[model samples]
Target: MLLKSPWSPRLAGVEGTLCDRLVASLSEDILSGTLSGGDRLPAHRELAWSLGIGTGSVTKAYAVLERQGLIRGIKGRGTFVSVGSARRDALIDLSTNTLPLMLTDKLLSRTLSAISRRIDSDHVNLHPPAVGHDEHRRLLARWLGRQCVEACPEQLILTGSGQQALWLAFDILCGGRGIIVTERIGYSGALALARHRGHPLCAIGMDVEGMCPEDLDRELRDHDSNGRRRLVYVTPTVQNPTTRTMGAARRQAIVDICRRHATPIVEDGVYTLGNDPSLPPLVHLWPEGVFHVSSLSKSLSNGLRLGVLLAPPQGIAQARSALEAIPMTSSPVDYALLEEWVSNGVADSLRDSLRGEALRRNNLARDILKDRPLLTDDSAFHLWWPMPHARAEALAASALERGVSVTAPNAVRTDPEDDESGIRLCLGGPSRAEVERGLSVLAQLTSDG
Candidate 1:
């Protein structure tokens, strides 16, 4: 909801006081939560037409709002409200891939303590099925179905982590030797695995919205459809390295392309924090060919090492068989704990808290790096900036020297020849003050050198 009502900005009195009235209306809406933290307001021209007031009023109101930290104007992008400041910690680290602890840690500790006391007598089956054929699969499926995916037990294969799920997806979908196409800038771990196994990665082009469907179609066409095409991997939501999310239409287009080509798609939701019912996973669109891999690592605790791979019945069975050989299977204790969390709504509660924290963190990042055009999604724990490859390296080094750590473009680039630079600033690890300090250093370096 951008604005509750058109011409809702209270217009009282004559031309001279229009700006003041407009500001009051906006302020009231913001305080009432009708206009949320990241909600974009109507453009000045459009609002003027609706309210029959001068555009100057809107502009003036925006200026005053910006100074008060109530709102901010992103160039080219619209104006959004500020969620206020973040809490500060000791050292600032922008390189972490993990999230801040929400309620999961406290819940986990309490659960573990209870489990330890009960572990004495009858808890013999400490090793659950690594393939997740039992309770874990059923519970997880029901929990995940909340995302509008509607997964079944037969279609879910449990793994130690999302990376493990990816490994299984690659083996089942690609047979270890075809072609694995992914976004040009993607998850470094997956890219590293592709390189290690000698899989020729066809890096597709991406923009702020995410992997371009036209570019993906082009890349798919160039390769021998029957011989080379294996799996097309993507992090559609909260995409790594660049915090870009594909809109519903873009995802549909990509799904249509893959479905037509008979290509198996690996959909990574490793870092996706939101379970927005509107943007369902690609697997929901085409369960037969789309393999959705997600984990509790981002939303819950990383140390739990609990991840699930959902595909069609046949596809998940094939992947599940490969899981038998992997040493890092979910322990029965942890599996049972995860099952309890899902069944009792603990996971959902924790996820909700994490989502709120992420929003707060994103707001902090926006306020800190607002001057530079940084890529960010509202619920993401990270921010990205596009720069020259060389400049990215220099800035990262400078940031590190100044006690702020960051990951630059080369780390996530799929091509060795790619010289385009970018930086991924993680906002989840540090406190508000620490992140502000780190961002200040990076911003100064970027602006100066």
Candidate 2:
């Protein structure tokens, strides 16, 4: 008779068969360090009884895990996790910036409980305004206060995602007619959004601090013609694709230049929540001219799909009107759970945990790529690894063959003048050990460069 297993596994979230989900759950648990080497899985019949599934399903799950090098079975003993099996020849992806599962899984039980107590009233409103519910906005405002930013519910426009937030900003502030100025290699999401809106992106030159002020001033002054509205989009802290930030003085200079040319700025502060405390948001400096867009997707959880576009009191009405056509707001269920989390202080704890993990992964990447040209931050979720454009491309291809994934050079390049060299490595996904393994493969490739 097979002995009983001590682990409890469930199949939920994302679509897949029962056996497949079981395999994925086991694999993920091992990678996350929740399950370690020599840990024995339950006997096929025993697990099937516990999970209320067919014994064959459990047997199939075991086979899949064994084939993936996740578990090994002995003739006399039950299946056990192989030694150092979690880091097997699986695809180590450093391309997606996402929160670890363990962190996001903390609030799910509470969220389900809270959501079950609510009653549906969709029949009450045939068409709700895109401004979103007042209660959610109030909660968002309260939460943002912790970040040293102030806003009222009237000035907040809730969006479905950060991408939608950028779209709303472009629609209302820029009107999609004038030239949009941005850093030479800026956030990939913002670049795609601008391109989709058919706006000309004037990619400015940059330094270590990001987005050169002199280049921005020239771009603004040169395009100050025919009464065309010019908009400057920037990510000042923990910038994506480059992982660099602008100092206070550099930020002030950019704001001053925008003011001189009367050009409005859309400050993408999505990546600043986990950044240094000393760096203040640009909206604090010039609220009227800055359209600040941020989201819980980065800080809390990506699947939440909740973002806020906070405008100054003077511009809130117009911003609200622009979203009227699209109705780009968060859903009732999403907002309710996010509010519950915020009210109970779960969001803050989650943010802190995520920041800690990001730092750990960043350190691992630093160690692997030691003495190489790296652009990184202690709090940021990703880094910039610079190499010759051609070499970067070749190395990226090689990395793919070695089962490592990374962002290519052209994906984040803002302009033709920008060098095609370098690739952005996201250090947020997977575990610290997994990130280190991926970076080791990349380190060998970097040695050639």
Candidate 3:
């Protein structure tokens, strides 16, 4: 049936029966390893016409095979058999992916030179201040002030990274047994910290705008049995995995809701910085209630591992106390390097360059996956594509076989219910060649089915 369907020019009268037989035969071929990994199926219409069957029949057959985990699709790309069943060796290493681009050699050389000068200075071995040395603090404060115009230097607190800042915020706002609200498909780090610290995490529904404010208020009101307070964690700007940026109206609504409930919010702005300057940060709007956190790792360099924590004036004392207990002092060298970058405007330059690169990569992605609606922010470094079929596991396995690593949404979730069957393709981590190759493979997969 498979051979006849592929070669026959006219079976018009028995098209329906022939299509049924074709589906069955193809399924056996897939199961038997005849149509292996990276193998492209004929175009849907072409295949249908070739076998003299109605296109709908071929469509239904493909859908059935997909649902049964026999084949996979990548929107604009072609379909292929699941890697494990076909080859068992295709590896796409997208799990825990990093940004595709790296700091230019010139920038790295300049940073190294600055670090050398700092080390050679006589005060190198001295212990830095608890809040951070004045010079470094000033640099960070300036950086933050520039990005969040409404913010002053007094509002900024330097931390080792965004995760540290998150821990500090959570530690200050909620302790053991307190209720915390996060997106249904939230960042895993926050979830893990909540679990280890014995805090209760309530998954809240989220759309493109971000955590649904109505859902959040309801969860808090329902869960606050004794009128006890709760803390809400959100990534409002270029949210991870989903890449959804909350618009102004939605942000205001969220702030209003949180204020009405008197709920403290931890706004993770790690990916928001150095991109669009117009989108006012939650910190800018709700400085008194929002604990804003950002890291240089994503915008500048991951190895720097430096983050800034901006706390509401009222919560400063508690946040500072928490930070002191865990990270009494950040590494001097790292701080010095970051300070040098910020002071000389190197960090800002890198950020600007990265923004352009991100746009380019995003544009490339949009062009490549044009057939699929990509959930992405042009200025952000990642693109989220919902699978036409929920075969993220199979697709990821297939991509991995081709030496392209892509992150499946399943691994990014904290709760099983929060998991979505999609993939996040990062444009910042791999070399341009590698990214192109990986994306090419992904494009093919999505288009096939």
Candidate 4:
């Protein structure tokens, strides 16, 4: 006996190919509560027959939805809607890992006004240089210098964001032909980029110091034995989710391992601005072998959409040329605004203010979950609560039911089978009151253990 599925997607007027349109319709329904969490979905063949679409399209749509964390499938029980699927506006929304909006209307208006008055015909008419203008790079280099990163403007390639910089580094360094090594738990953006590019990835185990140098050496040695190319990507300072910062010795050791293996590194320093910058980044240790990436989104304002890729002397031309080939979304106006902010000390002011706000949120979380263990520091925008994978997912579902959103475990863990799962609570996206409320909910839930 065949039972009809309760949910059916309306694809009329939805734009895209068959598969894309199907995905869009289903996503809209799921997010809008037309289709709900835990509702059983029709099997591919069943849905295809009902919708008059090919089974392949249905399969593809399901894959897309699953990737977006909107749906899930159990081998025998069949596919079902994911409980994590909810309209973002209805929740406290702690999943987004970005600095909260601290920019006042007055400051932004002043900055834009200043930029508009300075816009010249030549600046507005001409296309930006492939690697950004010298003045823009110079200001960015000066900003990096303040953070203890020594680099010249010539070696810097301006990017739209930290994610784009990572994309460029992975594309050029690996060329989708080699292995990408990173920590077991890493930034979701980088991991997704590697997977999307079809670059083979391996995760190194970590200790209290962050990426284990000994494990990295062995992995590189094994891969090198096969004449394979490998690139190491790491986030040593305030590592994503875990919020672990490596010391000077640990950084040197990891750098030494990669240098010994003759493998290049793409170091992510986006979070370094908010942390203690006394410890030098890996690029400073081995500038010729590391591609350092940083951006102003975390510190100043995400609206700026400005980032820089500090390449080695030998790789400067190649990185620049590669970036030039891709169509850039940033405009001359954006660069001018960044340049103005950096020059007038507005950038530093915003960062200091955001840092204070983040610290306050962190303290609140600490007070609420004082007895519970956390993988967080006072400087980071997010905190991690480690638990079993099943428990983590359960906690997320529980929090969602209470109207407090959190990052799903699948977004953070590299292996689904790994027992150690973590739930990342982003404190920077929501207001201080909302963050406190969310933390209290989590505290109550965890206390029920």
Candidate 5:
């Protein structure tokens, strides 16, 4: 007698074609542990008869499962879950930091369809102004107003991504000659950019409040005496990797230090989206002295790739010129679609949902690692697990061996000589269950001999 498959998913209410839904249901079961590795599945005709679906659909679904390494079949024998499927499914990823899937396929399709209907054929062919289309900029300006950053559309220059915005800022402010100063452990992307461009980078110290004010004041004083142009980049809210937020006093101190030396500050507000605007960004605190760079990649979806550069009045001309100098500008279609989303309140809804998810994941992490020394805020989707240098290395390696992926230690370090060591656990990319499993494995690894 052939072994009957345990598959019984409700197809009456599920979306997608029979085959697609079948594939999705089976995949979910296998990944969720409802279907274990090595469990035998019913033959195509058997499953088709039991599920009341066509045999062809069952065959296609099984073929897809095989391609995904979720199941296998042997000649003259029924299909069975692949022995490695459980391990593959159990391999949790906590390395990427971004909001979960707030932008669903249906929502994106609807938004794109609406944009297509409104935009004319000629408009599609024409290149938008290097600074961005006036309408798009106006919508963005309104969004900025909500964030409490007062700016007209002209000050907001569109870019491909937050990284691109940083590149443009560095090009204009540093001009390949100025020194870049940031916290000892800062955004890896910014640090890598400075190195790639051969710009000198100075690493300052940080405390519980983040970016030690004294260290920054001292560095700026020295660079000022030498007459070296300097750009201070900071992530005030939910600071990357460390997940520390600067207090109002610290923000004022940072602004004062920069102002005293007449240096420009590039405020990375990418992580500030969906966060409390009451704290205000460094740019808002000192608009004339700060260049604010932000994007939708963090708060909504990385695929958005919609970035904005809020340059000070004095640097507007230079920033716009730098943007136009680049051979490519942001996609007009993307901007149009984003404008629709924002106007329709879809963007705001997604942002609010993401904020809620971040809170859920952060709480879960804190609970899982309750006894461990953790550095993270309620709004942050990642946490810092502090440990000795050698121990951090060992912990990361050990966690991987047990099927948990984590960020490498050196990725966020600004100075190789700096002794501070820790691992960054990103909780945004994975599902809640995956996060729980991954964090449980990490907790176990940290407790082991």
Candidate 6:
């Protein structure tokens, strides 16, 4: 008699069927500690034959497990159980996650074609200069100039990634003893960087429009009395954690304030692309005082690690000098690949696809969280939901118990005293089915009286 299988029918293909069973079996084994951490699994063909399935099925199963973090596949070596699989029992990773919607095989094929064309011309590994290849820089600068018409290509500088650009800006502009004003709840990366550099972080208040102008003024005034200058950092478009976008009026007010005080605003517009085109960047409004940072990671593949920094005309030389002091140059191969993608319109296609996927996930969240109070912008990739009964950590822990991972507010806060009770759920990180199931699990946990 054939053995009864506990796998789901939703996974259909031969490989999917085999993978489903293997994942089910492996999940149980891992949880039971039978397949302990660092234990290697049998070879693909070996496992397939033993399980009475095709080798392709075994491969697919392994891929599923790898994506789920149950296993880690070494390039040459065999696959082994992940170290933290057991410890991840009660953690839902709704934090620091992203998913690509437009990474279609067609787009991949086109990108590969473009890359192959470049490789055929023998332009793969040649490092052009510290800044970047002139062609790539011009292309990117042209694109940015069109996006934010106020700034020209002369003001833009290329970096390896958005985080790197931010670091460079901090180092060049807000050196020793300066105050960096940020939102009470903001991107933790900026906060961590500030703390690491030993700069004082003045947490300012924010409203639906983003940083309150009055609070910004107050912080500036307070810092002025202390004989220190202040630099402001903000993510005006689709602000992380809160998923709130700053409007035009607020943008004008911020620009006006920066101009008046000569305060430099490092505006993170990483997520601004692939959204509604009408949302103008602050850099466009306050070109003299605003420093703009953006990246292609969220829209395209994160592996590229390409970022563009647009500084004021006067600050460009200083910014480039600071960047050279740290990471002098980014990988040429990555830049070439990114430039090829951008030239072929593959990047834009991917952005559109990712945006649509984010919308669908947001819709799913709306349906599941209909009764619950959640903060989300239609254009953002993540949502912020407050748990009524449990603290953010408790809720995250509870969700993790059900095999879902999420990030609590505390994980993203610079100060422990900051609000410790909300969670940021990334709609882009997991597969759609996985997100649906995960959100269902979360809804159950949060709904429990």
**Candidate-wise lDDT, in order:** 0.72, 0.75, 0.68, 0.79, 0.78, 0.69
> Best TM-score goes to which candidate?
4
| Positional deviation of residue 365's Cα in model 6 after best superposition, in angstroms | 0.9
- For model 5, the local distance difference test gives 0.78
Candidate 1 structure quality by residue, lDDT tens digits, 1-449: 34433325555321114564565556545655565677677788888888998899789877756664667888877777766511122335677667775554577788777667654233344554557646668867876776566787877888888888888888887776768988988787788677656678888888877899999898777767466547899998889878888889988999999988888899998765665678868887888888898887776765778888887777756665676676445666766677667667787777787788888878877776677878887777877888878777667555644555565455678876787658888887776677778888876776643
Q: Candidate 1: global Cα-lDDT?
A: 0.72
The candidate with the higher TM-score, 1 or 3, is 1
Total clashes in model 4, counting residue pairs 3 or more apart in sequence or in different chains:
0
Evaluated against the true structure, the overall lDDT of model 2 is: 0.75
lDDT by residue (187-242, candidate 5, tens digit) is 76787788768778899998998899999998877655355567999988888889
What are the clashing pairs of model 1?
87-432, 88-432, 88-433, 389-421
140-240 in candidate 4: lDDT tens per residue? 89888887788899998888888898888887787866688888887777776777688777888988878999999999876553544779999989998
List runs of model 3 lying over 4 Å from the truth: 1-92, 104-106, 114-123, 225-229, 387-390, 418-420
TM-score of each: 0.74, 0.76, 0.73, 0.83, 0.77, 0.75
Identify the candidate with maximal lDDT: 4
Alpha-carbon deviation at 394 in model 3, angstroms? 3.2
> Clashes in model 5: which pairs?
none
Residues 1-449 of candidate 2 have per-residue lDDT tens digits of: 65455577676332234664575567656655566788888878878887898999889878866765668998987789877664545667676677666443445976878766872456135455668777778878886777666777788888888778888888787786767888887776677677767777888887899989988888777754466577889998878878888999998999999988888889887774465667778888888889888887777776888888888776778777787777887777777777677777777777878778778877788888899889988777789987667666567556755667676455677774566458788877777778888899988876854
Cα error, candidate 4, residue 202 (Å): 0.8
Q: Is candidate 2 or 4 superior in TM-score?
A: 4
* Candidate numbers sorted by TM-score from highest down: 4, 5, 2, 6, 1, 3
**Which regions of candidate 5 fall more than 4 Å away from where they truly are?**
1-90, 120-123, 223-228
Off by over 4 Å in 4: 1-89, 224-226
Q: Can you give the lDDT of residue 225 in candidate 5? A: 31
